[model samples]
Target chain A: MNNSEYAITVKDLTKKFGDFTAVDRITFDVRKGEIFGFLGANGAGKTTAMRMLCGLSVPTSGNGRVAGFDIVRQAEMIKRRIGYMSQNFSLYQNLTAEENLRLFGTIYGLSDREIKTRSQRLFQDLDMESMRGKRVGDIPVGWKQKLAFVAATIHLPEIVFLDEPTGGVDPVTRRKFWELIYKATADGMTVFVTTHYLDEAEYCNRVSIMVDGRIEALDSPDNLKKRYDADTMDEVFRMVAKNAKRAE
Target chain B: MAILNALIKKESLHIIRDPRTLLITLLMPLVLLLLFGFAISTEVRNIRICAVVDRHTDETRAILERFRNNEYFDFQGLVASTEQNRMLEEGLTDAILILRTATGNMESQIIVDASNTTMAQAATGYIESMVSGQSGNSPIISSTLYNPQLKSSYNFVPGIMGMIFILICAIMTSVSIVREKETGTLNLLIVSPIRAATIILGKLIPYFILSAVILAIVLMLAYGVLGMPYSPASIVNVVLFSLLYILLSLSIGLLISALVRTQLAALIVSAVAFMLPVVMLSGMIFPIDNLPIVLQWVSAVIPARWYIAAMRKIMVQEIGIGFLVGELTILASTTAVLLTLAIVKFKSAVR
Candidate 1:
């Protein structure tokens, strides 16, 4: 595929800590307007790689381009063009939902009028108009998760990197959370998400299973299941992750 | 600039909503002012004393007699050498005067329980003065020049100011920053398109204003409540110097937040670990001269030491600006170094 056709193009990306390699020579491409799943067990180095891609951390070696900007030299430019929702889904608990959205909007350099207008639209779009002025802490975890997603995508970057956005929640809420991701992709925003849930991998247009700091398998869930001759994505994951000493 | 303003406003809301932060920011200075000013005085008084004398001499008798009459000593009467340790360990005596005479002139030692540093120092000091007065030779008359009344608050107000600043600016700032880190909000800020400097400055600006308000409150209490002398001549210098000190403390907080990974670690370091040096080595209560040689070296780096010294000169002595040159230079340079180090560490440590 042409480099410009991809929203994220990573070539031999690696990260090392003193004597141990955390993310070792991983290469992948994520197309625009697709929900891409990064699957790994605990300690599989998924978050480290995502952080490097998002410019929150520097890679030890290799090259990456996110939203058409070099990850290393153009980290600031890349940051401007991408949005991130960290593992915690960290909206300020003390702030009202509107305040949280406004804070993120303004940080993206949106004018006050723009922030107000867009946030109103976002709350409505998410069907979360009732949660606008309530403190985030006082809200349920499910609502907090949705608000955090809205905050991340408030500026409407070309790419949204979600680091395990739904780790702990009811199965019903998790399903609704995926709907938000679907809505974003429908708006032509690329979605890069990490989750340990094999069921969620099926929601992605394509998924990569990481083992021992490298991508052991990368394909659509149907293709991976077919290749592994497995009835479920869980079996496909276990088949590839069987060799991973790092998976805890 | 608009982003910074939003961040500051958001942070202000956080501070207002957080009871822990609000308590430390608002009520802490008042408690510390009273705690140091009246409750926990350093001016040692009415010490319990006993003596173990090996020789009976007119000189020794005179010294014991002086102790009996002195208002600072309780003069608990003579105890045998065998009872010396028992008296001290049992807490019956704050100090034991041990006098020995092999030659014509008697030599003496004041043995005190060294655990309570302030009490030990005071006990020994009173005994030394009593002993010197007994010796026929004329003793040097050294009276306090600045505070003739020798009120402990005169010394404590500056120290309270030092502590209040550290608690608010350093401890509170670090905790606030690390709270973001703990909640994972800091990573969001770090990943934002904005410069890291803007996020840090915005996070700290609210605490800076809180520190300023506390500074005003403390100064007013020191003058009105504690009856500290309000020297108009040096007031401007005091405020300016304190402002610089606040920045220095804020930088330390930034540096701490950068170094630590958790809010608990940041709180432990900034609140508990940092306060020990401020109280002990900063000459806040104990004179630096009385500190061990190693601690004196350690105190040289404590920003509060320089700040408290500058404050004492400015508030108590009403000293001229020329007198503060050394202190001002040290404080300003330390602030510069810490601010640079904090900014650099903040940028690198997050990675």
Candidate 2:
């Protein structure tokens, strides 16, 4: 595929913290409009890698581009063109769901009229209209996770990054959250999500399992399972993670 | 500009929704004013005195009459010398005056309760002037300028203004920023397209307006309740100086927030780091000149020291800007340095 056809491309991307390398010589390409899942055990450098791609942290040595902008030189441009959500629920709990939506929309340079219309439509589509004026902290955890996703995507960027967005939710809510990811893909928006739940890996179009700052395996889940002679993604994850050398 | 407006709006909502912040903003000034105005005073009034005369000469009667006419002394008539010590011990009289005729001259003796040394010294001085009619060889007339009654509250109003503004602005801004950091919202903000400088400014603007409102309340209480002299020029000067001081305090808070990770740590650091300097080195409760040379040098760098001095000149002395150029320059320069440091630290932290 041509360079323009890729949503993200990295060539030898590396990040170091003093004597330790968090992401070492990583290279991959995320196709446009694909739901790519990043799988890693605890402290396997998934977050450090995502932080570099989102332009929140500079890479120690390497070259990378996200949404066609250089991650290091054009961080501000990358920020304007992408959305990000963390596991901790980044919305202001003191603010209402609608207020969070409006604030993020305005930050992304949306007009007042656009914010009002888009917020109304987003809430209706999510069936979260009842939460329009309620404080985020007063809502259930499942509902807050959904609202945070809406807040992150309010500007409708070309790509969205979800860092463990379904952490600590019930299985039913986790399933519903994936439905939102699929909906974004249906709209032709690329999704780069990180998760520890191996079962969720099966839903992704492609998956990269990292162990000790290196991408140990990258392919479709079916291919990984067949190649490893495993019956399930969990067994495949155990096989990949057992080879990690980093104690942390 | 739109992003800034949105951020400011969000900050304002946080302030409004949090009852603790509203309480501090609204009630703290009034509580502090009443505390300093009424409870913390150094003025001495109505000292109790008993007179003992060995013989009732017309001269002695006339002298006793003089003491009775003065408002500062509350005269308790004719106690025997034996009862003088008893009255003082019972706290009935603060002092005793004894007059006797020896040879052709009238002799006088004053025994005062010296437990509170300042008040004792002042009472003795008053008795001596009344008896001798003059302590100096020539009659000397003295007049008090500005605050003629020498009200202790006058000395405290400027100090209270300096202390309250710094405490509220510094503590509130630091805690608010650290709260966002602890909640992980600061990370969200950093990832947004808004500039770092804009975010810092957005955080400060609400506190700026709130500090201004608190300043106005403090000034109103100073003039209305404490009876501090007020003029339009003095009001302008006080407002201007307080604004500069508030800006400096907000910058200090921002600096602390940038360095600390948790809201509790931010609160403790801001309180310990700022309160001591503001109260001790700022000349709020003690005179800067009276402090040790080392402390005096430290006071020169404290923003509240200059603010309290400038505020006294503007509000009480009613001086013009020309007289306060040195103080205003120091405060303005310090504010610039702190704000630049806070912004630089914040940028690096986010990166």
Candidate 3:
């Protein structure tokens, strides 16, 4: 396959801690501009796989490329091209929204003029002009999550990895967050998201369900549901999880 | 360069916005100066004493009168030698001066409470001088060269400088970094394009600048309020030594943050492990030479020991760098070793 066609390509990627393998020879490919949902039970090793692909953790063995850079040898190059938002809200709570944006913008190597204009556009996009000067700790969790997502993609990275981005929030807020993800994909930015919420899995163009450190299913949500003979993505997940060898 | 600038700006904003950190950093030096300067004093003043004369003579009476008139002694009246031990046990008197006439010559004995050895030594010296002065023979002609009055504050000021700088720079920096780790922001920072070394140096720059500011305030109070000697050469020495000490402290903080996983652990370790050693083993309060041989060997490893010694030489004696090369070299090497270790630990931790 042409490397430019895929934002992330992993082959037999594995990570082990002592004798226990956290991720056991998982393989997958994510197309550019695709909103790929990585769904897993709590200990299914989804986050470990994402970490390896983000160049944050080393794979025990196997080959992986992120943004056309080798995950092992070109980790620094990969870091420069991709953005990541962790499961926890990672922005500085003491800093104002504008300050956080300025910090991430500069670290991402954006020029002063670009940071200024892009931040202004971001504030307008989120309808958060009033929050530009507010400390992140003072903001609601929903707003913080949305703001964190925008900050992660502030430099227009080719791929933005969101690890359980909408973990705890109201349904309406989670819907609004998915809208932002859709907007990024529309702008030709790949969205690699991990979520435990089965309902959110339906929003992805393609979904992979990991069980027992292995991908049990990877296809469009419609195809997964039809193949499992299930009515909903939740049923599809349940059908796949029954075969997991590792206990939750 | 841009990444470092952004990090520094963010760190500065954090310091400014956090009232607790700001309050401690600003007020610690002044508070410590007052506590160490006036409260923890070794200088003897108005020591309580009882005079016991078994066979009174004109010379004994004259000596008693002199003791009564002296300002260093608060005469607690005459006591029988049999009652002296009870008076001392009840804390009525700090010492007893006994005079006996024997074969046309008078023999004097002084019994002192030596629980606090430094204060006891000073009191004995004072009594010896007063008694010898009345014997028509001049007392030992001794003069304090640098500090004529022998103020304890002069000795404590440099030590306070060492303590305050290390406490603020090392403890604060480590706590701040570990706080980021606990809150998970450090992971985001590591995932960014900036190098780990850049992140560490960026975090340290603001602290270095803040420490310099604190040093300036402390020196001002030392010279302005406490009457510590100030000269251009002394000021240069202070600035140079303080900068080196700050670097050593920052690197130590970085090493701690790299090793610890939580903010609470960082706070506890920096306080008990780092701050305690500076206070007890740095010769800040107790003299290193007076410490046990084992502790003396341990003290040689503490950067604050060399720092406090160098500061005293510079600020009090107004000495040149020729006298401080050994201390400066030790401090520089400690900084180098800690910094290299911190960088290596941080790199591996990031991975």
Candidate 4:
């Protein structure tokens, strides 16, 4: 399995676009099989730092490891073991849900039988069997969100990164979507998700609050709420994010 | 290889589902070829014609002087008869006139490159009228060279091939790639283990195959329905030339995809910035010689100018492959440059 105690580890990871440091020397760790929340206001470098961790972009200066593979030199190996869903809900809308699953699974080098069995298991777990053959564009946005998760995890990747997977999703649907995330982590698959919504941070095993390209606070949601003298994660986030210099 | 197949399969699914890709690649060629073939009949202006005088005299000088001063033609001044084939074949002039007093009387013969049917027709008409309209006119005999049939479709076939190949291959490929960028799927692709070059190849191979089908359909219609002249001996030439031209068009699409981040912008640039010039200035429907000086310079770098011209030699004239050396070199080199630029730009753009 090659599973480490920590699914992701980083030290002083920084990403600069010219003089502007979008992700500035931030450090964090995500334990294996836990729901790790990455929270920030818009344009606070959540996407950039997540991209660096997911092996999508090179860090300007620092270090990162995902699933025991170095982010810089072993990016390809990291990619083979991880799945990603981008901020905009990025499955093929033209393809049927099953077909999208098949496509990603195949890209991860899964056999037809393996893709089919995994797709069946996901559909059953989500109770989305009736909609499996329907085109993703024909489905509702919440369903598309769930289908994207299925596509990302179809190959049984060790870790999955979701950039605002619940953005634009209804509040009730977002809560329901958490059930699937819980089930995934129950199977020992690590999840790293980014969101601007502080309410979602309450559901994480640990949450990091980033403000203006730096992580101001990182801890369990309960610990952050207690430390900030707040009753909710929203207050904790507001306490940290109040001094942000960057605009959305 | 499995990863590539998966990508190709996914890309093919996108191509099949998006009616725009199919509509452009499959139908654009047929419609443009048919519309331009029968519906359009435009008179050429500023026909560049040069003359070869065997022996100079007062009468011949007067005749040459009239053409030189005429507004309807850009006279490429007195060239030797030995330079006759060189001038027309290299596109220095549309046609050449052979004038002589070695036969005792002024016997003038006109030779126009039949590749450009409209310009050839226009140039031959103007020179014949000029000889007859003059005072010391001789026994004038006219002949259009290259191929005898000179079907008007010869003009439209090459022109439509140039316009629609760019429109379909470049526009569709660019829009498809850019659509991924717009939908945010390209970020997902980058996160995958696949290299940028593999992604590009998977995206392009399907279009390249579709381009081959479109080429076959276009050629079949041109040779069979429109009665354009094509010899059996030039089949290999047509195949090789079409393959090279398709590769060039696909690379242009890839470059466009790398430059633009939005699908709408890709479509607009491919259709307007590129295809429009091919139609307006590639000697497709209008004469390049007729364009203003600056536009003439603009048309000079247009690849279709060379593509349509060479297609004429291969499809219409059925000339030897040697005749297309200049056009082949231009297309091949441009393709190489564009492919390199596309790969480099694509890597940076995607990241």
Q: Which candidate tops TM-score? A: 3
Q: Residue by residue across A1-248, what tens digits does model 2's lDDT show?
A: 12498999998999999999999999999999999999998788999999999888999999999999999999999998888999887789999999999999999999999999999998999999898999998988988998999889989988899999988998999999999989988998899999978899999999999999999999999999999999999999999889788775
Q: Give each prediction's DockQ, rounded to 2 decimals.
A: 0.71, 0.75, 0.83, 0.63
The order of the candidates by DockQ, greatest first, is 3, 2, 1, 4
Error of 1 at A53 (Å): 1.2
Candidate 4: what lDDT?
0.86
TM, chain A, every candidate:
0.97, 0.97, 0.97, 0.97
lDDT of 4 by residue, A1-248 (tens): 45569999999999999999999899999999989999998889998998888777899999989999999998889999999987768888888998888888878889999998888988998889999999888999888999998888887789999889998888999999889889899998999999867888999999999999999999999999899999999889888989888987
Q: Model 2 segments beyond 4 Å from truth? A: A1-3, A243-248, B46-141
Q: Give the distance in Å from residue A138's predicted Cα in candidate 2 to where it truly belongs.
A: 1.6
- What is the TM-score of model 3 when looking only at chain B? 0.95
What lDDT, from 0 to 1, does candidate 2 have?
0.90
Model 3 over residues A119-230: C-alpha lDDT tens digits? 9999998999999999999999988998899889999999999999988888999999999999999999999999989999999999999998888899999999889899
Residue A150 of model 1 has an lDDT of 91
Query: How large is the interface RMSD of each prediction?
Result: 1.0, 0.8, 0.9, 1.4
Task: Kindly list the per-residue Cα lDDT of model 1 for residues B67-99, writing each as its tens digit.
Answer: 899898899999999999999888988999988
Candidate closest to the true structure, highest lDDT: 3
Best by DockQ: 3
Q: Which regions of candidate 4 deviate over 4 angstroms? A: A1-4, B43-138, B147-150, B290-297
Error of 2 at A156 (Å): 0.7
Pitting candidate 2 against candidate 4, the one with the higher DockQ is 2
How displaced is residue A219 in candidate 1, in Å?
A: 1.4
